[model samples]
Target: MKPLYRGLASATRRKASRFALETRLDAMTTRLKDVGEFGLIERIRRLLPGAPDVDVIVGIGDDVAVLETGGGSYLLATCDCQVEGVHFLWDTTTPFELGRKAAAVNLSDIAAMGGAPRWALVSLMAPQEILVESIEELYRGLGGALAEAGAVVVGGNTAKSSEGLIVDITLLGRVAPEHLLTRSGARPGDVAAVTGTLGDARAGLELWLRPESGVPEEEARTVKRRYTSPQARLLEGQCLGRCGAVHAMLDVSDGLLSDLRHMCEASGVGVELEVERVPVSPALPAVAAALKADALAWALTGGEDYELLFAVSEKDFPRVADQLLQETGTTCRAIGRFVDRDQGLRLILEDGRRSSFDAYAGGWDHFKAT
Candidate 1:
């Protein structure tokens, strides 16, 4: 870790430039982009802290970091990135909100795996002109959310970005080998349950992005909070792990239907979602009514809700829900049940009609060209 700091000068050496660089023939120079993706990753690996001696198996260089406790559990680690204009619009979202959201989203992934988060590493790519005060405030906001989620910030990196603010959060969590939930474990007859209401964040996004609309200040503030600082159901996820009831799990970062379909496809099962069973946010309906948008559609297809969805055995459903309430004060409701692979993914409407729903596309894919 001491040697890692030696490369800090490389990050801070360059001054902001108005024109592209075209240096003298023999001068040593390298554009940040010219560092190349692999080289930049090597630099980041060099900068990260070494894993503690007691529990780490692999760290800093894999697609996902790993740590073994030798207690029949292994820690699985991963991170997520939120970029301004791409993941969000800074003008529409407050720095405090953005910070909380960036951290919350990563924690949500950990929760989706039925794991309890233990550590976090945040990296911010700040623009040259943003105020130092704003940056400090953002950390305060993120710190609050991380505390609430039962995780700690162990390390971070800061650098300048010419585009917009960038927040990348890495999370480390521990899960018992027998209790770890993954998309590939679902089986026919397993029941699907979600921890909370959905679509509020997506509806909130619409409200925050459009200011000319006549929404009340208090309502606006609430929606903005949801869009900016949504919480991850980490406690509930831990309860699910303790209950030993979950088979497959995933966070609803993308649309609910899309992510659910992902779990089913991964596990080689099909799902039948009861539309009436999908929890609706109390605030979403009113906001959607004002905007002439369909609340149900928003709840079904909206992303960034950060809720946990998991499949459980029908026999363990009652015990699981009761444990969740006792531990998290959040109800875990069954929304559907898994079916045979050949049956395929389908949705049951409130009117008692059923239809097949296939994906045209789902979630944010950064590599796609506009």
Candidate 2:
């Protein structure tokens, strides 16, 4: 384990900070548009904390940082940022809901590890025109969600942004050594499962993005609320982690296909997911139909539902799914199976087609054209 000291450079280590006004740069710097989000992340992984460091059980990747502080359990640190235009919009989401969703995403990361969230640090960057009452409501929503998970906000920072509002939260959690689960544990033949229904958030997103879709008022209300406020499966994740049946786990912020790809890459395995089993939310089909969109597509490639996705062995999945339902009152679905790394990511369509289809680009990429 690597010490946290090297995770960040010393304030005195350099005469100017990384964000110094007059920072120097190389002769040629590629634009972020060319590198893309994951590419930029890979470039950063090479420059930062150099994993295999002392006291750093996990670093630079996976959803959270698993640290060894000589404590009873490993410390889990994760953060997520919500931007106004990118994550939420004032036209559809209230400040309170925005705040709640921001906190929930980070909570989902901790939940993925089956860890207990203990604390949070929320930093906000907003423009001057924002109202104080809205911000207060936002914190009220954020603090409320944290309280539900036995976590609290210790402190954070506030800065004025020339652009849109940004709410970034860093959450810390703890997981006993025996209960810790990462994305790298799935073995071939393991069953891939997900908690709760999928695609509701995206349906909700569409309510705002495609107003002319004519989604009924009742259905419209349902999906929009889900999009505005996502619940993190903290209790379900903890139960699954302790059950000893789950092989690998993560939250579905990046959609089923994309996150499955992540799980496969991390576990050095591959996956084959069934189209019929993807667990589309009940609220999705009607909305998708109204919008003339594909509900299955939303279930596969839509992001930000905050559901937990895990892999369990074929023999254990039934028991694990049953126990999870009984313990947390949350339904779990086994939608896919892990395969050899050589198989890559394969999907089964309703017509009994298995493919690594070139046209079905997996999931959302910040830098890639959709």
Candidate 3:
């Protein structure tokens, strides 16, 4: 007992000494809140910038890291995590739904790369008092989602979380060299398009948050399903890859505008989205109306749609969109066009007015004040 006390005391002293050192260096170091998530990513990228001169295929900035393995296919790897309070609440979310969502988000990353998912590693952290049966059901949901795309959960690690449940999954996939689309491939004049519709998932989230908004039960179900079970556009992505038409691509996990910003920055271009053309889900208007919200605003900044946002040459876009629809029974809409780097990101409103979109604002930031 004395030794244990001594060990704790030493640890406390070490922490205090480190705290003092940090205090001295405080002015030089910015807080996490100030940096935000993307800012921190930029800092980390600088510390370990991928090799120059084609040594690195795809580096830290994109959705999935692409690796060359001396084969016809490039390996795709991506991981995503969902926290209890930050991402969801047990009051509304089921363990099964949470598990399914966690897997689907990772699959969306692979889908963005136009890859076929093969394997997954799911790591989880839960409260010690969480029911073992609940964990089993969670795995059931996760495994079923993965299985739909021919992916299997091969292995994972488990830990006891102090507060909320956390599920992190690393998905592995492969894509043919010819079909491996990336965000950096977008070119000026490329017609930017998105698969399926937007705003539904965000509307679903709104319904959950504003239960008394009086949205009809059937309409609520439609939007809520979109939030809980996002179809990752895997088939549409594969079709686009095979068509040899898509120049660049990504999943709309971070809202159309924000993800478009990422693509523009990566491809060294600007864009102008036709606001009137942005596709809104059929159910979104009713939900937005019921909640007394601006439906257009929700579609613009609402993240987690998980639909595919892509670019193709204007001449090729029609054929590509048609092929995707015929092959996967999924539709796509061209809402924007890439432009000269100097133009920046702008939007054409219904009134024929053009305005610059401030990409850094009105989007989800993990560290930003909600």
Candidate 4:
């Protein structure tokens, strides 16, 4: 207890030092009412500057920052948002974790597009109760995730709000024009593939929401870690992009079924998802069984896995899977295939039962919150 208290005290002092000179005048008093939205944004913009060496035609001051890049490369852009209650629980999630989530979610979108994330703009809206130190920690998390994805946080807006916190990230990247992959590229007979396992993050979220499920300490911590820190499949996506096998790609932000439906709809095709072929994280079954939850449903509907879901030509499936495993150490497997448009999106159960799956929960809609 003594050592823990000492460490916490030291952390508090360090946090204070980190913001020694950046105090807002109304911070200690009633909420910063005088600092208008634009004033707060200007303060944040002043603190965050653009990266050196990047060609900047238009930076931060306009409606959208435009960039001049060498021709022959395709432009890839993705936007994602994280909200307090919907995406995270304030009591369980750290500021640093929140920041990483903000960035990684957007980077996952870039990965889904089969591009390398080059830059990001992070816009944050939070209640006045959030401390300056926490905000800095959030940026640190964002920086760490950006570094991992080979992206830079160029600029963004930050302002106080009485409502719940929100972090919106827009990521921009480039890939060889020929290498660009979108959800609209899947075709009949194309093989469906996924990077890494699914359901781990969903299991983690369940553990987080209900801690009394009798999970062992180590297992519980692992689940909690997955919920807090999900890695974007940037390297895997890049490798797949270079492999010339990927056709259509998307991040599994919603459950596998939902995201797959998205790709199918966009591509003007239908898909047959094999239940047995879907890879479940090793921890998923045990955790779900203990909680009396359906593991398959969890994997099918779980969000925040951040894994890449892609389609490839049938002839390229084996080679693509081999290269992806060798290059990124992430497992890639064919889960299904694109079928005729009339077949629609169908899920084949283990018992050989088939049914159409229509998921109501789209990818993180704020207005649909319970």
| RMSD of candidate 3 to true structure, Å | 3.4
List the pairs of residues colliding in candidate 2.
Answer: 1-53, 1-54, 1-55, 1-56, 2-53, 2-54, 2-55, 2-56, 3-54
**What shift in Å separates residue 81 of candidate 1 from its native position after superposition?**
0.9
Q: What are the TM-scores, per candidate, against the unseen true structure?
A: 0.79, 0.90, 0.92, 0.78
Error of 4 at 94 (Å): 0.3
Candidate 4 deviant stretches above 4 angstroms = 1-70, 359-370
Q: Ten-residue segment with the worst summed lDDT in candidate 4?
A: 57-66
Residue clash pairs of candidate 1: none
Model 4 clashing residue pairs (backbone): none
Per-residue lDDT over 236-335 for candidate 1, one digit per residue giving the tens place of the 0 to 100 score: 7777867776887788877888788778877889989998899976777778877888888878888788888889999988988888998889987899
Q: What is candidate 2's lDDT per residue for 1-370, written digit by digit as tens?
A: 3446545766745665565433356436566667887888899988775546688887876999999987699999999999888877799888998888888999999999999999999999989898999999999999999999999999999877768999999999999978989988999999999999999988998888887787788888888877888999999989988999888999999887888888888899998889899887677999999988899888888888899999899999999989998999999888988999998888888899888834476777788644
Q: Give the TM-score of candidate 3.
A: 0.92
User: lDDT per model, in order?
Assistant: 0.79, 0.88, 0.88, 0.78
Q: How far is candidate 2 from the true structure (C-alpha RMSD, Å)?
A: 6.0
Point out the worst 10-residue segment of candidate 1 by lDDT: 359-368
Error of 1 at 86 (Å): 0.8
Tens-place lDDT per residue, model 3, 164-184, is 899999999999989999988
Candidate 3 wrong stretches, greater than 4 Å: 1-28, 49-55
State in Å the error of residue 57, model 4: 20
